[model samples]
Target chain A: MITSPKVETKNLNLYYTENQVLHDVNITIAEKKVTALIGPSGCGKSTLLRCFNRLNELIVGTRIEGEILLDGKNIYQNGMDVVDIRRRVGLIFQKPNPFPKSIYDNIAFGLKIGGMKNKSRISEIAEKSLIDTGLWEEVKDRLHTSALDLSGGQQQRLCIARALAIEPEVILMDEPTSALDPAATFKIEELVTQLKNSYTIIIVTHNMQQAGRVSDFTGFLYLGKLIEFGNTNILFTRPKEKLTENYISGRFG
Target chain B: MNIRNITDKFFHYFFLVSGVSAIGILFAIFVMLAMNGLQTFTDVSISQFFLSTRWNPSAFGEPSYGILSLVVSSIMVTLGAMVIAVPLGIGTAAYLSEIAPPFLRETLKPVVEILAGIPSVVVGFFGIVFLGPLIADVFNLTSGLNALNGSILLAIMALPTIVSVSEDAIRSVPKDFKEASYALGVNRWLTLVKITLPAASSGIVAAVMLGIGRAIGETMTVLMATGNALQMPGSFFDSVRTMTANIAIELGEVPFGTTHYFGLFAVGLVLFFMSLAVNLTAEHFTKKYRRYRT
Candidate 1:
């Protein structure tokens, strides 16, 4: 038996004014699985990740030509609310962009925006999300402190918890652990592995070892094209495309 | 020493002379005002100057210079202008720095700043020609010039400073703060209120103080539009006189050594102290904000 794709992108083209960024791309992300998009810098991996939730719409002069379907509904359809889409398909950025607010408020921000008004309920959800992200033990005592005071790794985890507090079905992470130390990177990878059991996860990363360890499926992107994608074991060990072989073998970035 | 050493000594002397000259000018002005006005403080009760309403310096064939009415009128007009300018200026700044597109912002920002370059007399003329009559007709008054007219003119004059300084401060906020708010799906207005404005609070306060300083020190606009009545402002439409206006109007008429002459000096001293206090407060907040950003 086979399952339907949770998110499907068909002929997705994005341009920054006269400069084309992502060219004629097509991909599908399986539901409730960890899928990683791997590429070098400026390979359009982050841009493609932003399409799932329409985060690119915030930039001026950014135009997109494509169909991105979330659970079979076109997200770009007329009258579709971008806020609602973002709430359901949350995104964590490359850098740890925590709000200059309390640690608890950082997680509660999304919930309050989504119309979750009950204070007790917000606290409950924030605590649960922090625990799920494995940051509860370290920050449980200072929940009222500013989020910016946290270490880089802890801030990234706090961002993850913020996204999780919204109860998003799919979480998009763009180089989530790249800014962290080795030990924090290991901890995030463990958290990602555990999170995949409940939520569909798509991550963009340049670290091949990280992708290999955390992702069950891998898609190789090179120069704005999805060159090849398959099970992580086969794609890393025996890639069919010469470009993928060259990229993974470390001949060139 | 060589010729070069001699030239360097001359240059150091030039710097020292200019720096000391600037301070000396300020101290000279203070001492002059104090010496000229010392008799008023000794002979006249200070409370009388602060409490009495009549400003007829020539009344009863004697100098009857009471500035309580003029001071109160100045405060009223300045307060009214601040109430109008601060919100509009800060809102326009927030719009320019955070919301307006690059094209619109580029065009509107300079247009807003151009208000600062226009001469204050020209602004007063405009108020006298336009706003004064409009207000006079609405209130069925005999004269067009009044506190309302002066306040409207001063508010327009103060707007450019408030908006430009505030826009700079809001622009100085880190881009990451905005990104964090947007990522949470909070709307633009809420983010400005909750995050951006709070982070830039000290800067905004400084901008307001600068605007107040500009409004209080304004002379020509108040002289022309406020009717120079030297009476307490009973309402927005009532004619009034400010301390700056009083000094400008009376300085040439009073004899050089009479009580009336020293009364003008006293008013100047009051104006000087008010501006100094405002500037010092702004400086303190600016330093506090700089430490926070660092």
Candidate 2:
């Protein structure tokens, strides 16, 4: 497997004020493949995912050192446009956070923000994205209705559609199914499987079984350090690190 | 009964009495206003009382009880006050909640609260001595006491309420909404204007409504700053009298039980309804805002 990485982090370190969270993490994420980050609570898995899109900069006192390169361009460089970085790498949160807008507007929002002004083009992109997320049929007749009216699963799918509508190269999911039920989680897992062929995905999930089911590569983090990084099947079964073994076996956090 | 049951009964009766007394006071005021003001309808027709622009309570032969001018003046002053206050208040709130550094926000919030605590009479005095004279000079008016003067003072008085409530609303917008907007690559200004403000709109609307209620019910400031002239204002600078000003000025000198006194009471009743409408609107919007939280 000699595929070049789509995203690479070189000695990435992140801090919130004086408290360091992620320390000297280095990994290369292959293109059009799902890479899952698994760790215990407060282990900085979500923080790492947010760093990909520079979402962590929103919090005051946050500091990041080292490089996060997207397509070989260092995103952390002074001249790098953060908005372009975010547009290139879309993110969805753990909880479904659809705007309190019409269902149609939810998908249209990203397009509009990305400067897609033509109404017909926006509608076409919105419809295609919704269909890709498999929500168009159920909501086609009621596109004008409030997005809040949708069920939690539908809303999560809608959020995915919103992220996809921007046509990003990579998609980051921060425990996107944790708040959902098992059925909805399965639906999302299946959707992730289908989405990976077209977009590079980096998912942060606590559910180990889900990481195995949906991801190609799995990275196990412990106390802000990358403990193990390998194929999902190999890491789950034959982890090289003791901490990874204990964490995966549920022996200890 | 046991001692616990007896104590419970006593407390329940006490609570009931307190609640009834509060309601009773409101009932008593309504009854007083109705009993005194209803008779004005006999001397002056309902249409004339509501529609006529002329208000000459001490006319030589016949007194006119028309409050049209007063109502118009009240509306003009309130509208003017809102026009001045809304932008300033909301802008201050946005800056405090979203943009201002913590040190600046902490220093300014208490200053706004203290502004709310200033006595209306003191504000009225400032309006008469300073604001009125300044306005008169700037606009080339004969007198500074006018709707504009009253509006400026009322706007200052209303600022604290609007800023505090709107700031709270802006702060309470879930961090997730902001994150989502930011993840979409939208800038802070667009995020505040589009997502944050729209999400917090119900609360902000309630804040503005409450501010309007305060401006409409304010008496001393308007009475002292506005010329208290019985005229429908043609412009913000024109001398005029608000409903509260009319009631305050007449209630002091008009003999009790006279038609003049009753007319003032009628104006009070109308003002009460206007405040009630404002409060109900505020309440409605507040409830609607809460529905968005969950």
True-contact fraction in model 1 equals: 0.42
**Pairing residues by index, what is the TM-score of model 1?**
0.91
Off by over 4 Å in 1: A1-4, B1-16, B34-39, B54-57, B61-66, B288-294
Q: How many Å off is the CA of A219 in candidate 1?
A: 1.7
How many angstroms is residue A148 displaced in model 2 relative to the true structure, after the best TM-score fit?
0.8
Instruction: Give the winner by DockQ.
Output: 2
DockQ by candidate, in order: 0.48, 0.80
Tens digits of per-residue lDDT, candidate 2, A56-99, equal 99899999999998999999899898888888899999989898
Residue pairs of candidate 2 with colliding backbone atoms: none
Q: What's the CA RMSD for each of the models?
A: 2.7, 1.3
User: Considering only chain A, what is the TM-score of each predicted structure?
Assistant: 0.98, 0.98
What's the lDDT for residue A80 in model 1?
90
Docking class of 1: acceptable
lDDT of each structure? 0.88, 0.92
- TM-scores, each model vs. reference: 0.91, 0.98
Report the C-alpha lDDT of model 1 over A122-143, residue by residue, as the tens digit: 9999999999998999999999
lDDT (Cα, 0-100) at A108 in candidate 1: 83
lDDT of 2 by residue, B53-172 (tens): 999999999878889999999999998999999999999999999999999999998899789999999999999999988998998888999999999999999999999999988888
